[model samples]
Target: MQSKTPISDPTLLQLPLDTRTLTIGGLAIKIYGLGAHSASTPLTCIHLLHPRQQTHEYMTGIARSLLHTYGTQALICASFDSRNHGARTTSPLANESWKGGNATHAEDMFSVYHGTVEDLRMVVEYLGVYLRRVVRHFVVGVSLGGHAAYLALALPRVEGVVSVIGCPDFVRLMAARAEGCGVDVRGVFGGAGLGPIVGRLDPAAVGMVGLREVWRGKRLLALSGGADGLVPYACSQPFLDEVKKAVWRGELELDLEDIVYEGVRHECTSEMVREIVRWFAACFEDMDGGSLKSSLAL
Candidate 1:
């Protein structure tokens, strides 16, 4: 089933800096304050392949940056753990028959992705309800979380997405994972027919093709580092190609852009955060050209 569902039994407690902690649909999430000038709605951040602890500061910082740039209360920010990653390191489904029934680790990753897509949708829907406002939503994700951002694009409310160091084509990512350093295939992957395993579970085949409809009026910013050893430039080609197609078709007006940090790799630097903050600002307004250039140049 698709992850799209109404929020259930959500409980939220407001804290300092306008942030809050809430649990809904069995997931725990953090919400940073709404932008000074924004509605109670939010831009959600999906963490990397890891859990929420590692990237919380950076993710919340993006929300804070948006608040500073837009100066509007419309841009609230949020984040949550991916399946079997951070706090929920022991996902119930991870041990279910469907998880490892197929013997390839790439497929295992797909299983995780499937669960994450659901988790994200649940949270987005829940937040919409909890805020009790006419909320507009945006998403940003890193690594596997970035891929989740792409999937979230299909949601009607998600108007913009920033996918950092992530790819839309799961097939390619699976191949890369299959070849990651020191992968002992004889045990987890069952050691045979690696190529065929990822083929059956291609995210494109699973559900990404509909991004055409989902992306009709959306904006996307894809960031990659040139020297990165993992998730090399090629892995992002499919997402770039999709963006190019949208721009050529006039389906996107603002933020149809991509950037590569020649010296950076696998990791998004503080400078990248500045750039993303700028990209989001462009999405909301035609701000002064002077500040605009500085955000992108960082």
Candidate 2:
């Protein structure tokens, strides 16, 4: 299944912002206005985050496909290029000479995780006023978006988190990338500068403690590609282990479902999109195929 499917080009309704800013520590941020098509009350806000290299438009296709199949509407969908990427990059040779070496790339990821999570929380807070037409609110994210979704779920308002091929163990992914390049995790994470920050932010180790504190009794729906080269199976295994451990301790009763598609690579496939749509449809009530304009209007 090597999941690389073409992104869908969708026509969406752009919404006017109501003037709100969420403060995350010292940083005050606003949610990018993607669009607002009113759906039935209790709308499902599908916030699709991009993979490491992809753009917001790449995930928009997946979001539109799911919305089309399930007859759903997204209140907001947004993504930003990570540090050392796009225009915000600080790398000196980002255009020609940069090979995306290790070192600070991991730190950039940490920043992305933090920034994305803050944005997700702000969106969730904004939507909480009117989107809660139902009892449960779901947030579905793919890959790096999945990581952001997990962080969003840590908030009390998020009812469920559906992550596909999300890298929960940041250190492990770095370590795997390092190992693939014949480097050492110990030397890398234990080195002078990278070590201390990694110790503080590594999701596999101490970083996830706050997440775990909020993870109790939360429903987690996850999927992974069996043949993902970038995100190895071993990496996903530890996350599953954490979930299972939480389940055993009565900290979380994980109604977790894992679907591993054979031959699927790091990208998402059309079949996988269909599966996600089917699952999302089940989460809604009285889903009837109707006109996009009317169905979205509450």
Candidate 3:
């Protein structure tokens, strides 16, 4: 693979794990993604979480392309089924909220975070131990996967985080959805003793409160499409605003470019993909003071 252009390789590798089942807090979960790592890799590891209800192949391919384009070779990409979205149907709350639980949706989300962070932690630990490599690990996610990425970053292993088209205000979105369904959102989280819990687990709230402390001096990037409707471009704005006025203030920058390809929705676009690749490439490539190009390798 040359540094001049990104690789067009579609070949992906699947790990030879005995089992993909992960048990956390008495809750079982499944992971359906790639675990690709070559011998003698570097420390800057990448953990990519896919969108809701997406396959591992799709997510891993995107991650691989991003890594290849960025010239960041020290990376390992992994994607998993959060709950009842994929091959984890045996688990409770598959494709639905927790049944008869006091907090319902909030509890479900909590379970997801608890389970997901643990899975990611295990992967990082395994790579560090078994692979005998990796020092600086970063996480990137999109949509619901973006929230999971934040959760993983909150864990011990993750060093930095990149959230793409993810809404940090989980409670707010659920509340709006509840209203759309004619259900009282406040009653759901509040009545179920989830309001405070949500305050504790909400990504936006967490980012505002202690994320800076946890990720102090760490590079964080919030990427989103300007015309995104599903996750809303507004979601990333408030956090950027809060961080600008906060304790961990530094050269933190947020990229707000929207790829306007036809029929491109909340999903990843070729331009967006190429931009990510170029950004990664710029990080490692010797630029020789030349202006970086604004494009993707579609």
Candidate 4:
């Protein structure tokens, strides 16, 4: 689903900036563009997630970019530290992979991201009440955050997801990593292979039949790096292929746009950010049945 057209540099729309923080159910959530003056208005909230070992501050620039583009439209951007990250850091070693000496790398990473999904669900459930306004939820995740974005698809409130360098097949990715790291695959995947815990949490383990129900009516824009050595695109291709098949067969009504940038690495490039902004604009247009050309105008 790579785009044939050339991707140009993004021209950000500069607007008034408003930043604030709230502690919701023990999670410190940072919000941008939604202030006391605008809390009563209905808005769409886009949650931005950072990469592994990074804090919510890592997403500040992108949050500002999104707010500048949609702030006037009652759109707010929010972000929070994932489990074992930022303010939630309990054991830094738990964040590392097998190569970094984490014996239970697979379970640790999966739990962190899966727990993030649950945290998001709780935030979404209570956010409206706090603001006293109707709120819609969308998510944009990068690297480790991207993996969480896939799991967030199951959330009833999340309508769209933008995954940058994320993998859907956690078991495959972990198996490959374990092999390369000289760690016993059995230790990671277990003696039975693809351990019960991973099978229960991994998105690819859900199978296409289950995915049909989870992905229906959702919008996904997956940006991958073709040469990504860390989270290789190959690990996710099989699942993406099945997703496309389901869509083509009318079994899943999903708005899926998966693109691989040739020669790119695991990093999120400026071009990827541009595509994300454009995709968000397009999704907003589709939802409202109105043009946002002016909002995106340079």
Candidate 5:
């Protein structure tokens, strides 16, 4: 894939936005940053995923910012509400945690985000057909969306990922939450017959060998808050450590960036957003230079 130069004129950044909403696979998808010139240029689609309990509209600002920064370069930002969220809300109780009186918090949360990965795959397939142009896909997910971003690595078109305050190890995160909430973790995710269910869905349970195959040649930028009480970095540390070790041992090839902002809470700060944009810019540069590997080729 030959990289095209980004439009340098600042005034050109204000090009008329080609925003639209489409219903695909029964999910409403909002797209931004495409214009009349999009078909002539190679396109990069970035999916903006919002936090838990929030709708796709919450990602509008980030989508607009990305469009403003790379709109002239044929960049398009897309977003959709996760399952049991926004217009997809079938049961509000399923979104709650154990403390909120949801007995199946672990399974419920995993199903929503895991289901998101499936939704993303379907969307990616349709976008390629709908756009009728060369397009590379990337993802930027916050909190609940971030968790889905990690799982999306299994997909073919997801070339890069930005996980903001997301956990790769669902079991670790749920276990900690259950312990804090005085819920029996084993009953929910571990021991008994529930272990297999989680092992089948959890990324960490896939083990390093499986991860090497899924993560090879991919790029991941994980932004976490050091002081986040809700989804602390500790929940993801063990999994990340193994990833680093795999790279060191030459068992995996990946571009991984893990940063924890001090004093930041569970929220996605402005600094994190800026970092995400910067990372995407760098990835584009690499892609143009033929340095970044595409999942499609893998």
Candidate 6:
């Protein structure tokens, strides 16, 4: 918790990247990647977000690690800027993309979540054209970016998701903040209730609550801090409970894994990052030749 600086994986820095700019409806996207090993391997995109409270350089090392590990014949790992974060901040957010984040801190945070998810959507679509032979996509996001990862799973193109210190139930999150932190519910986010907007965007509504097929097929790994005072575990506990219930009934094709660092706060530890890299890498290693390959874009 003392450092917001991302620990550099020295070896990762040595890897070369294929950097380029792609226009998403007049918005210039700056993205960099490292691999496309072959026709058999498709890219697995990782979307990252840097909210106001966090360090801007937070995801760089993680991106590098991913590129080093899966950017081979196994996947194509890439990172793009969300609106107002990196290269796209000057591009504009109100005109055509998301208009959600311009208010208060919490409102802006949620807006960033919405905008970044859409940014990732555009990036994924662009990648489909840029890397045509690629397979399925996987997303790993932290904090606000974590929200984007959950939302991305709703897309048919995305088969896997990793959400760290993020919440999907916007209503519950607000409720928790109101109760735990004593914020006004009705005026919690910029004096406008967040319930309605969250309802439309919450991943819980899409994956759980009986979207049986998507729930069974999509692979999800949720990481949280047991002592997270920011976005308390109760905010996501209900959704986690639902995922478990579904998996318990013999409905899941892949495991829905959730890990909480007992005393850790709302932050990612070094071990958590390593586990994320390993877990994502494990996705394709089983190589039944059919499951992973078929999971990619065929």
Question: Which sequence of candidate numbers ranks them by TM-score, best first?
Answer: 5, 4, 6, 1, 2, 3
Best by TM-score: 5
Better of 3 and 4 by TM-score: 4
Give the TM-score of each candidate. Answer: 0.70, 0.69, 0.69, 0.89, 0.90, 0.79
How well is each residue in 18-56 modelled by candidate 5, as lDDT tens digits? 678878877899988666454656678899877778888
Clashes, model 5:
0
Deviation of model 2 at 161, angstroms? 2.0
lDDT of 6 by residue, 1-298 (tens): 3345343366666767566556666666545463345544555556555433343366666766666666444544555556566544652333221223322445655677787778677766666676555546678777666767777767666777888888877767766665644455577534456656765677675565545654446678888889988778878989888778767887655567898889878787666677788787567764434455354443
Worst 10 residues of 6 by lDDT: 94-103
Clashes of 3: 3
Clashing pairs in 4: none
Q: List the global CA lDDT of all models.
A: 0.56, 0.55, 0.52, 0.80, 0.80, 0.64
Of models 2 and 4, which has the larger TM-score?
4
Candidate 5 structure, TM-score to reference = 0.90
List clash counts for every candidate, in order. Answer: 10, 9, 3, 0, 0, 5
Error of 1 at 44 (Å): 9.6
If both were scored by TM-score, which would come out higher, candidate 1 or candidate 6?
A: 6
Give the Cα-based TM-score of candidate 2 against the true structure.
0.69
Question: Please, what are the lDDT tens digits per residue for candidate 4 over residues 109-223?
Answer: 8889888889998998888778887788889998899999998887877888999999999988887787798876766576765478667667799877777776777889999
**Which stretches of candidate 4 lie above 4 Å from their native place?**
1-16, 191-194, 290-298
The residue-by-residue lDDT of candidate 1 on 64-118, one tens digit each, is 5555555443556677766666566664444332223433445455566657767
Distance from true location, Cα of 260 in model 1, Å: 1.2
